[model samples]
Target: MEVETNNNNSYLSVVRRSSRRTSFPTLQGLYVSLFEGEITSDGLDLSISNKNTGKEFNPKLLKITFFLSIFISTVLCLDHGFVSCNLEYIEKSFGVGYAQSSFIGSMVYMGFLIGCLLTGLFLPVLKSKVLLIGSLIFVVFSGIYSSKSLTLTEIYASRFFSGFFQAFSIVYLPLWVEKFSPQSSTTTWLAYQQLFSMVGVFFGYLLGGILTCFTAEDINIYYMSSSEKLSSLFISWRGPFIIQSALIIPIILILIFIPGEILDVGDQEQLSEIEYSKTTGLLVSGVDLRRSTNNNLLPDENNLNKRNSKLRRSSVLLIPSQSNNPNSSKSLEIREICSNPIFMFSTFAVCGVYCFTTCTLFWLNQYFVEVIKVDRITSVFSVACIYLSGPTLGVYIGGITGDLINDYHPNGFGFILTLCTIFSFIGFITSMVVAQTHPYISFFWGMIIILFFLTSTLPMSLIVIMKSVSSKTRQLASAIAQFSFNFVGFLLSPVIIGIIMDIIEYFPFGALKRRYNPIEVGIKIMLYISLPTFFFYSLATLCSYFNCLISPKITQKKIIIANQIDIPKQLFIK
Candidate 1:
C-alpha cells in the first residue's frame, strides 16, 4: 500500500506540471475548471478528492453553494448601486441638500460598523448559517422599509439597517468560499465574488438609470413634504428597493431549504483534514497530504540534510508562530490580529481602495448631472458603464493574475499588488486633473482606467489579509476588515466629501462664489484631497511586501490552515 501510494504521488506530481501546459487557454475552460472541478481540456486536473478515502465528493453540492454565494453577493450589491445612482432622486424626495443626502450613504456604513461589532460578538456563539439567515431576514425587511420610507429619518433608518445586515454577508460569504473552495483556486473564487459584487452595482445603476428615464423632469418638484412625496402616483426612486425586496424573498427561501449540514460554516475541526490533492486535482476532503511530498520524507542522507537546511532557513524568516488552538479567547485573537503588521497594512490598502470606490460611486452620479451638464440618464448609465468595465472586470482579472503569479512565485503576488496600486494612483491623479478640461467622453474613459487599477487591488489585498491570520481568527479578521474598509470608504468618504462641498459652497467668497460653480470646483478639490489615499495604498502594499520577506512560513501555514488542513506531527522536520 505504501509503495503504491508513493507511485500515485509521483504520477500526480508529473500530471500537475503537464496539466498546466495542456490546460485550454479559453475562458470557457477556466470557468469549467473553476466550478465543475473536473479534468478540463484533456490535461487540467481541477477535481477535488478525499486523500484518506481516495475518492471525490460530488460536485453538485459545491456548484449550488458556489453559485448561491455569487447570487447573494450580486443581489446585495444591487441595493448599494441603486441607492448610489439614485441619490439625486432621493435628495429631491426627501427635500435635502448634498450634505443631508450624503447621510443616506454614510448611514449604511454606520449600520455596517455596528453589524461587524455584533457579528464578532455572536460569531463564536452561533453557526455562520444561522447568522446569515438572520441577516438575510433583516436585509429583506430593510429593503421593504426603504421603498416605503416617507421621511428623511425613515430613509436613514432603513439604509442604516440595510447596511448593518449586509455586514454579515460581506464577512461570512468569503469565509464560506474559503471553506468549500479549493485552496489553489481560493483567490480566483474570491475575485469572482468581488466581480459579481461590482456587476450587481452596475446593474443597480442600470436599473436606476432605466427608471430615471421614465420619471417626469418635475416628478418631485411640487412635492414639499414627505407625505406629499409618497402621495405621488409613482415614485421612481423607490422602484429598486421594492424590486430588491421581492428578489430577496426567493433567495431567503432558497437559503432556508438548502440543507444546513451542507451549507453551514461550522467549526473547522468538525471537517476532515482538507487540502488540495494532486491526484484528486483541486480540492480533497478528509485527509492530510502534507507528508505526501518527496522533500519531507526522503530517506537518503544527502536529501535529508538538504531538507533540514531549508527548514532552518525557513524557521528564521517566520515570525512568532500563531496559536493554533481554536478555543483561544476572542479578545486575544482580536489583539493578535490588530498587532499583526501585515494585516494592518493590508487593511490600510483595502481602506484606501474602497474609499476611492465609495466616493466615486456614491457621488459621481450627482457630479455628472450637476457639473458636467449631462442629463440624468446619461450620468447614471455612464457611471454604470464605468463600474462594469472597470472594477467589475478588473477584480476578475486581478484574481486570475494573482493566482497565476503566486503559482509562479509566492513573492510575485506582492509585486502585483504594488504595481497595481501605483497604476491606480497615477490613473486617479491623471483622471481628476484632466477631467476639468477634457470632454465628458474622455473623462468617462479616464474613470474606467482609474477604477480598473483601483479595484484590482481588492482581491490581492483580501488574499494578503486572509493569509496573515490563523484559521481560528479568520472570522474575526474578516469582521475587522469589513468594519475597517467600510468605515473609511462608506462612512467617512461621502460625508467628508459632502461636508467639504458644503464648506466650499458657503465659504465667504462674496463676488467670487458667483463666478465659479461651487459644485464643480468643490468636486474637483474633493477628489484631489482623496488622491493621497491611493499613494497611501501604494505605500501599504510596499510595506506588506517587505513584511512578507521575513514571514514566508506564515504564508504556507495559513494557506494550509485556510483549507482546514491540520499539519501532521511527522511532517514537521525535527
Candidate 2:
C-alpha cells in the first residue's frame, strides 16, 4: 500500500495504494476529495473526463438535483424580480420617491450581504441541509409579511428578512448541487443553476405584471389616463408578494425529499454495499486478502517492514492542521481568494455585470413608459419578456462554451468572460442609441443584445472561480464572489441610479413632485456602468493568461489529496 514515486522525477506521483489505504484519512488541509478528476504530477485539470462513471451511476439523482437546484435558485431571485417589477406600484402606494423606491430593492440585497457574511460564520458548524430548509422557512414568513405591509418601512423590514434567508440558500444550493452531481458535469450543473435563476427573474416579472393587470381590473383601472395620478390605493401590489411567497412552497417540499448526504467510496458501510465484488475479495473464507497479497508480493519480513516504515513516515498526518481551525477558516479562505488575481478580478467583473443587469431590469420597463411613450402594461410585459430571452440563451451558451474551451485550455473561462463583457458593452451602447427608434424595435432587438451579453458573465465567472481554487475552499470562493456581486453591484446599483435621478430633480425639501420621465438622464448615466465591467473582465483575462504562462510554477506547487493522511507540520500539500 505505497504511492510509487520515481526518485528521478521532481513532481509528486499519483498511484494506487494497496486496499489497506484506499479510504482517505482526514488530517488537515490534505483530505480534499469528492471531486472527480485525476491529479497528475503535472497539474490539476478540471476537464478530466470520467467516462465509466456515467455507466456506473444512476442518472435519476442527477436529474432530480439538477432541476431541484434550478428551481431553488429561481425561488431565491423571485423577490428581486417581484419587487423591482412592482417598484413603481410600491412607490405609488406608499407615496415614496425614486430614492425611497430604490431602498425597497436595496433592502433585499442588504439582507443578501448580511446573510452571505452570516454563512461565512455558521456554515462550517451547521449542516447545509438544515440551514437551507431554515432559510426557506424564513423566506416564507418574510415574504408573507411583505404582502401585508401597509408602509414602506414595514415592507423594507420584510424585504431585509427575505434577502437574509435567500442568502443562506445561495450559500447552500451550489455546494449541495455540486455534491449531488456527477463529477464530469459539475460546471454544467452550476450553469443550469444560473439559468434557473434567470428563470426566476422572468417569472417574478411575469407574476408581477399579471397580478398588476388583474388587480388593476379589480379596481376598475385597467389603464389609467395619462393626466391622472397613480392610484395604488385601489391597485394591489400585494398580489406579487403573495405569489412569490406561494412559489417557495414547492421548492421547500421538493428539497425535503432530496437524498441525504452522498455516501463516498471511502465510507466503509456504503462502500461494502456498492462494491459487492470488492467486499467478497476481502472476506472470502475469513482470510485477509490484503495480507495474503502483501505476503505473496514481498520477498521477506525485512522488506515488508521497510515498506511499512517508509509509509508510516511519509503518510503520518498532524491533527487539526493549522489551516483547518474553525476560528481562522473564513479569514484564511478570504485571504486566499483575494490573493489570487484571477479570482479577485473575475469576482469584481461579476459584480459589475450584476450591477448592470439589476439596474437594467429595474429601469428598462419604467424607461419605456417614460422615454419611449409606451403603455404601462406593454412596457412591463415587453421589458420582462425581452430580458428573459438573453439569460436563457446566455447561460447555456456561456456555460457550454466554457466547459468546451476548458477541455483544451485552462484559461478558457476567462477568455469567454472577457469576450462576453466586450460584446455586452457594445450591446449597451447600441441599446442606448436605439432608444430613439420605435419602442418595439428597441424592445425586440436592442434589449436582447444588451441582456444576452451581460447575463453570460455569471455562469462563466462562477465556473472559472470554482476551478481556480482547491476543493477545500470552493464554498467560500463561491460565497465571497456572491458577496462581492450582491454587495457592490446588486445592492448599490438601484440606489445609485435612484439617487442620481433624485439629484436631477433637486428637491431642496427632499420632495419628488414628478414621475418616471424626469429620471431619464439618471438612467442614461447608469448605462455607463457596463464600461467598467469591460475593463475588469479584460483584466481578469490578462491575469488568466499569466496564470497559464506560469503553468509550471502552478503545477510544481500543486497537491491533490484523494484521501486523508496524517503528517508532520513540515508536510503541507505544497
| Top model number, TM-score | 1
Error of 1 at 359 (Å): 1.9
lDDT by residue (1-574, candidate 1, tens digit) is 0111232333211122111111111111111111111221122122223221243445797778789889899999887787777776777766777777787868988999999888766755677777888899899899888877767778899999999898888877887776677647878999999999888888887887787677643444444456545533244767788778778888888888777655555554233223322112221110112233443333444543453453343321112223334576566667767766556766776787777677788778777887778987788788888879988767878898778765654422356557567766776776576556547877788778777877777787777677556554676788898899888877887877777666656668655457666556655654564366566666656654554443333323322222313232112212
Q: Please provide, for model 2 over 1-574, each residue's C-alpha lDDT reduced to its tens digit, 9 standing for 90 to 100.
A: 3332222212221222211112221212322122112222122111211222223445777577667767788877876786788778767667677889989988988998989888765665566667777888889999888876766678889989988888988877666554555544666777888888888888888777766775543222333453222334223566666666778888778767765453121122223223332211211011112111111232334544454443332222212223334587667656666676666777887787788778877887787787778888888778777778876787778777766655544323445556656766675676567555555675567667766777676777777666655344566666777788888988888898888787756766545535434557656666677777777887877654554344333323424333433221122222
Q: Clash pairs of candidate 1?
A: 48-283, 49-284
List the candidate 2 regions with Cα displacement exceeding 4 Å. 1-58, 215-235, 262-329, 410-414, 421-425, 428-440, 508-517, 550-574
Ten contiguous residues minimizing lDDT sum, candidate 1:
25-34
- Top of the candidates by lDDT: 1
Candidate 2 has a TM-score of 0.73
lDDT for model 2: 0.61
Clashing pairs in 2: 1-18, 24-563, 24-564, 25-564, 316-566, 316-567, 317-566, 317-567, 318-567
TM-score on alpha carbons, each prediction: 0.76, 0.73
Name the lDDT value of residue 574 in candidate 1: 26
